[model samples]
Target: MPPSRQPGFENTRSNEYWFCFSSPNVESHLIISISENHYLALAKGPLVEDHVLIVPVEHMPSTLSLSSEFEVELCQFQNSLQRYCKSQGKEVIFLEWVFIRATHANLQAIPIPSSKAVIVEKAFNLASQKMGFKFVSKNFDSISDGRKFLKTQADEESSLSYAEISGGIILLHHVEEKVRFLAQFGCEVGI
Candidate 1:
C-alpha cells in the first residue's frame, strides 16, 4: 500500500506538505512559475543565496521519468534562464540529480561570479577524476547537440546529464545500482 496522506491535503507530491502550492510554505518561496505545470522557487537550502530550483507542479520521480514534452519545456526554460543570468553578469550552473526515490524533479540553477564561472567545468572534471570516472564531454558545437545529448543519455536508466550551462554539457551514467551515494549530488564542487 502507498503511504497515507495528511488530512485535507490533495495532490501533495510524495506526501510532502510543501509540494502543495496552496500551502503558505510553498507560497512564500515561489519566485516564478515557468508554465502551467512548472515553477521556479528560491531553494530553501541553497548552495548560494540566489540559487533557484526549477520544479514541475506535479511530482516526477526523476528526469529519467520525465515526458518528452516536459523535457522540451525544461530546455526552453534553461535557455531563457541562462540568458537572463548572463545579462546579470552571473554564470549559472544547471544541475540535476536523478536518484531512485526522488519525490519531485527539481533542477538546480546556481549562479557564481564570472571569474569562477570560467573554472567551474575544471572543478567538475577534477571531481570526476577523483571519483574515478572520466567525465565525457558531449559534442556541443551547437545548442542542438546539447539537446540531443541530454535526450539520448538521460533516456538510459540511472544516467546523468552531469552538468549543463552556457559553457556546454557533460553527460554520465550510473551503471552500478548499489552505488547510490552521490557525495555532492545537489551541491557545487569545491575549487
Candidate 2:
C-alpha cells in the first residue's frame, strides 16, 4: 500500500491555501520583508500581537529538507526578527511543525515579553506531560548548530515539531506517525 496521506494535503498539491505568502496579490501591509528563499509576513489569525510567519518562496515540506543556502537565508530572516523584537522589549520563539507531506514549510515567530521568557520552557514541559509526549531538549551556541541538530534528528520521512527558543536552546519532539498530532501544538504551547 502507498504511504498514509498527511491530513491537510491529501487532495492539494499547491500552496494556494496558504496564500498570504504564495499569492501575487498578497496585501503589502501584511508582508514585512521578502528574501531570495523566504518571506516574513504577519500571520493570519495570529495567536498573539506581532506574531509573524517565515515561509519559503518555494513549496516544500520542511526546512530541514532544504539546502544550506536556504538555511542561511532563513537564519538571516530569523535574526532580523529577533533583533526587531528585542528592540521592542520582547524576544522571539520560533516554531515549526514538520510533517511527511505538508504543502509548505513555514516558521512561526512569536514574540513574548522578555520577562516571561523564563516560563516558556516550563510551560512546554508541562504541556508535554499533558499531551503525552516527551521533548528531547538541546542547547546550541548559535542558530546553525540548533538547525544542524534538528536536521540530523529528523528528515522528510519523520514527523516532528520544534521550538527554537531565545538564547540558543531548542526543544524538539519526534511525532510518531501512528499517533494523532495537534498541528498547532507549538502555538498552543506558546499561548
Candidate 3:
C-alpha cells in the first residue's frame, strides 16, 4: 500500500508537506544509498544515463537551508560521485535549483563524457546570458568549500540555482522573485 495522504493535498504543491523524496512508499526502489541524513537515488525520468539525485531524508526546502552537518554529508556524496565518474572516464556536474516554494531539496548529479566536459561552463554561461541573468562564479578546492560559500549567501528567503562542475567550479545565479525559471534548465543545458 502507498502512504496515506491528507484530503485536498492531491496537487502536492507545498513546502510544508507532500514530498516525494521523504516518502518511502513510492521511491524505495529508486534509492541507491543512504547516508546519516541523506539519500542518493536514481533520478526519475533522467535526461541522460547515470543521472542521479542527492536528497536530504528530512524535508528541507533547499541546499542553502541545509545544516552544516548535512552540508558535509552532501559534499561527501558529491565527491564519491565525482570519483566514480572519473574512473569511468567521465566528468560529473551537480545542479541544485532552489525555488522560492521548493519542497524537498535535491541536487542532480549528471555525468558527461570527459571530452565534452570543457563546454559545461560555457554552455551554462550562454544560457544565463540569453535568459537575462548573470551567474556569479567562484572556484573552490572542494564541494565542501563551495557549500560553505553558498550558505554564506543564503538567508531565510533565497531563490537561486547553482551548478558545481567537475574540477571545483561553482556557478551561481540568484533567481529574482518576478522572473520565471526553467525547472529543467540544467538538464536542457547539460546534454
Of the candidates shown, which would achieve the greatest TM-score relative to the real structure?
Answer: 2
Tens digits of per-residue lDDT for model 3 on 1-191? 11113343433544233225534344567788988888888888887789999888876767778888888888888889999999999999999887766657788999999998888889999888888888898999978888888888765455788899977899988877678898778778745
- Compared with the true structure, what per-residue lDDT tens digits does model 1 show for residues 7-122? 33244444454544544556544565658667788887677767887777676655545677877777677777778878888878877776544555777788877778878767
lDDT for 95 (candidate 3): 91
Clashes of each: 0, 0, 0
Candidate 2 error regions (>4 Å): 1-12, 20-29
**Local distance difference test scores for all models:** 0.63, 0.82, 0.79
Q: CA shift at 36, candidate 3, in angstroms?
A: 1.8
TM-score of each: 0.77, 0.88, 0.86
lDDT of 2 at 142: 88
> Which is better, 2 or 3, measured by TM-score?
2
